[model samples]
Target: MRLGQRLRTIADMVPIGVTMADIGTDHAYLPIYLVEQKIITSAIAGDIHQGPYLSAKNAVAAVQLTQHISVRLGNGLEVVKPGEAEVVVIAGMGGANIIDILNSRPEVTSKVKRLILQPMIAAALVRTWLHTQGWQIVDEQLVQEEGKLYQIIAAEPGGSPVVEPVLYEIGPLLWQSKHPLLKLHINELIGHLRGVILAMEGSADAVKLAKYREYTIRLKALEEKIRCL
Candidate 1:
């Protein structure tokens, strides 16, 4: 099975020989690819919608991996039990939604060895929550697919005791190591903030002015960080 750049990157992050539960698995492509490559011995492909659930079921059957991949119809991580999977992957969802899913069943998540998250937006929130929950973000990858930039985060148990706001905004691992894509991503963010600042230039509202000032300061800080890199 051919996986897209985004899914392929996420799949590469999964450790070999570990069972994984792919939550909200739209087409079950990731699990199917992993099993076919013998990267993971087994996987549980779970989905909340019937359409995707049936699609996943059919996909697994077509691949002749019925015994290795279990197609489950459920919401979030509710389909799997503790100790059933070593890793849990929740991708293609918003950061807030991912946090809610993890929060829904702490018992199951607490037992898992690692979590691979691919938040569609508000990724900073996911990072912040991970830090607070004691899940250390071990690695991150940034990829541009079809003109859109995507961020993938891998976290495990035992995180840092401190969760800085800047770390959440800039990504601790990505910023500290200065990943190749970090400068580009930061430049994009600076552009966005500049646009916001420009939009708020003529506003008389105190709130808008306050936000403009804040964004200006953030833009300068991001530029300085990029320069240092």
Candidate 2:
């Protein structure tokens, strides 16, 4: 089975010979691919909705991986017991949602060896949560698929908190690694910030003005980072 560039990048972050639990597994493609490649011998494919849960079950059955992969329907980490998986993968969701899932089940998350997260938006929130929870980001990758760019973050237990606030938004590992998409990513952020600032240019409300100033500062920081890049 083949996985998309985003999913493949997420899969690449998984260590070999470890049990994995894929939250919001959708069709269970990631687990199936990992199992087929022998990266993991056992996995739990979990989804919240019935359609996806059944789809994941059928996919595992069609591939005859039922013995190795278990498909469960439950919310977030509730599908897997504590210490059941070495790695937990949460992808194709918003950053806030991912954070909520991790926050929802401390027992499950605290015991996991690693977390592979792919948040479609508000990635900074996810990064901040990880840092606050003492999960050191080990790797970060960018993959553009169908004109959309996705950020994949791999983190493990025990790491110091990120000091720079901007690093949370831009991803410290991505900037340090000098990812090929860093420039484009910065440009996109700058563009969005500019739009926000422009829209609030004539606002007389104090709250809006404060937000406007905040965005201006962020815009300037992004501009400086782009120049450095």
Instruction: List ranges where model 1 is wrong by over 4 Å.
Output: 161-164, 197-203, 206-217
Best by TM-score: 2
State TM-scores per candidate.
Answer: 0.90, 0.96
lDDT of candidate 1 over 1-229, digit per residue (tens) = 9999999999999999999999999889999999999999999999999999999999999999999999999989899998889999999999999999999998899889989999988888899899888989998889889998888999999957674455576788889888888988888877877887777776677435666777777788777777888
Query: Which lDDT tens digits does candidate 2 get at residues 37-131?
Result: 99998999999999999999999999999999999999999999999999999999999999999999999988999999999989989998888
Instruction: Name the best candidate (by lDDT).
Output: 2
Looking at model 2, which ten-residue stretch has the lowest summed lDDT? 201-210
Which pairs in model 2 have colliding backbones? none
The whole-model lDDT of each prediction reads 0.89, 0.91
